[model samples]
Target: MKRAEVLVALGLLVVALVVLSQAIHLGPGWGEDGPRAGFFPFWLAVVLGVSSLWVLVQALRAPGGAGARPFFPVGGRRLVLTVFLPMAGAIALLEVVGFYIASLIYLVIYIRLTGRQGWPLTLAVGVLFPLITFFIFERWFLILLPKGLFGERLLPF
Candidate 1:
């Protein structure tokens, strides 16, 4: 268990370091009156990297800490698959369906998968939530979300 925790912590730290480096390379560009686009992300990456390093140090130094448990256990295929499947699908959907549709689909899948809600309620909330957001952002606030395959069809209306 301690070994597993150490491994996970180190892995997370390495990933964070890589991300932090990338974020730093992508300079924050100054916006109208606020910080640059990459400013927040860059700082967030720095924080994540530092935190992960701290966790790695703790896990390594106290292999058998009294209150510690294994970060990952052996033969945890179900756990890996459970998280990876949805994330992969979301990445694919994000490209093909655009953010709005992808987000709606992701939310519906998540609510149903996690909450086990009824179909009718899930459908209602899923559809309405995105619609309302679209109305408020696109129509009222003049904020545009990505339009994927349905972009051209929406132009007339």
Candidate 2:
């Protein structure tokens, strides 16, 4: 567990550093128009780097030390896969069916199977959630979301 934590922290730190470098190249300061392209990324990378560093330090100083404990308890892998596999499938479906449809499918399956909720509640959430998200992002915010391979033909929006 300690080893895993340390490794993950280090990996995140590396990613943070890479982003920070890119942010610097892209100009992390504010311009006349407002914040530069890299402003938000720069701060986000800094925060990630600092947080990861803290985690790495804590992991190194942990009582049991690296590799002294199991990364996951009994049945942990199964538990993790139950959630992860579905989400991964959703991501894979995104490009094919679009965000709204993929999310609706994912939410329905996740809520129904993992949460063991009644059909009414699951169906309500599955359908309404995507519709609400569509309105919020497409109409209110005027931000275009992916509409899949069929695009507007799929939703007519």
Candidate 3:
């Protein structure tokens, strides 16, 4: 388990480094406010890379690290899939369903899958969280999230 954890962290570190490199290639805007398209991405990639490396280091030093344990322990696979699969689905859903629907679906799925709670609670949170986020980001901040089938036409900001 520890070994796999370290490997995954290392992989994330590598990916972040790649993203950082790509971002750095895109020069930031010059003069006055110096933020370009890649400014945030590049910095975020740096932070992610550093953090991933730190975690990798800790895992390497820890007892029963990834190399010492089974690749998938009892309940490990379920835990990993439950967390990662939904996150991947959320990203994929962004293009197809857009942000609101995709986020709502993700919230609902997360509640249902992880919480093991009742339908009422799951539905309430799933519905409310996205609505609140929609209002906060779209209405308040004047920012737009991805739109899928249901988009600006139906729910214009």
Candidate 4:
């Protein structure tokens, strides 16, 4: 578990670094009117990097972390798949349903089915995210996102 944790953290660190590198080109600073193109993504990368670093630290601190241990525990593959498959489905749904709705559905499934969270937390996460994202990106930044099948009729934004 420790070894696996370290490897996963390292992988996330690499990804975060790569994202941060690309985001720098996109511009991470604030512009005259609002945030630059890369502002959010860059910060996201930073958070990912920080969290990964923390996981790496924990893994390294664990006893015999460097010792031989199978990368995946017995049920690790199932856990990975459980999380991954929904994300894959969400990605597919994004094109058909657009970002907000697709993400909401994905969050609902992930929070409720996978996380086994209560309705309050599930609904809060599922609903608030899209609403906040819409306001932040669409209203504040005046950036238009994809309007899929249900977007035109159902959504006012």
Query: Among these predicted structures, which one has the highest TM-score?
Result: 2
Flag regions of model 3 displaced more than 4 Å: 1-67, 71-73, 153-157
Best-fitting candidate, measured by lDDT?
Answer: 2
Model 2, stretches more than 4 Å misplaced? 2-67
TM-scores of the models, in the given order?
0.51, 0.59, 0.54, 0.53
Model 4, 116-154: lDDT tens per residue? 899999999999999999999989999988877766666
Candidate 2: clashing pairs of residues: none
Residue 121 of model 2: what lDDT?
A: 99
lDDT of 1 at 12: 74
Candidate 3: clashing pairs of residues: 1-66, 2-65, 2-66, 3-65, 3-66, 3-67, 98-148
Per-residue C-alpha lDDT of model 3 across residues 42-76, encoded as one tens digit per residue:
88898999999999999988899345668777888
Error of 3 at 133 (Å): 0.7
lDDT per residue as tens, model 2, 124-156: 999999999989998999998887775457777
**Can you write out model 1's per-residue Cα lDDT over 94-155, one digit (the tens) per residue?**
66766667777987897799668998888888888878988899899999877667643544
What TM-score would candidate 3 get against the native?
0.54
Q: Which segments of model 1 are wrong by more than 4 Å?
A: 1-58, 65-68, 72-88, 149-157
The list of candidate 4 runs beyond 4 A from truth reads 1-71
lDDT of each: 0.74, 0.91, 0.84, 0.89
Pairs clashing in candidate 4? none
lDDT of 2 at 131: 90
Q: What is the lDDT of residue 38 in candidate 1?
A: 70
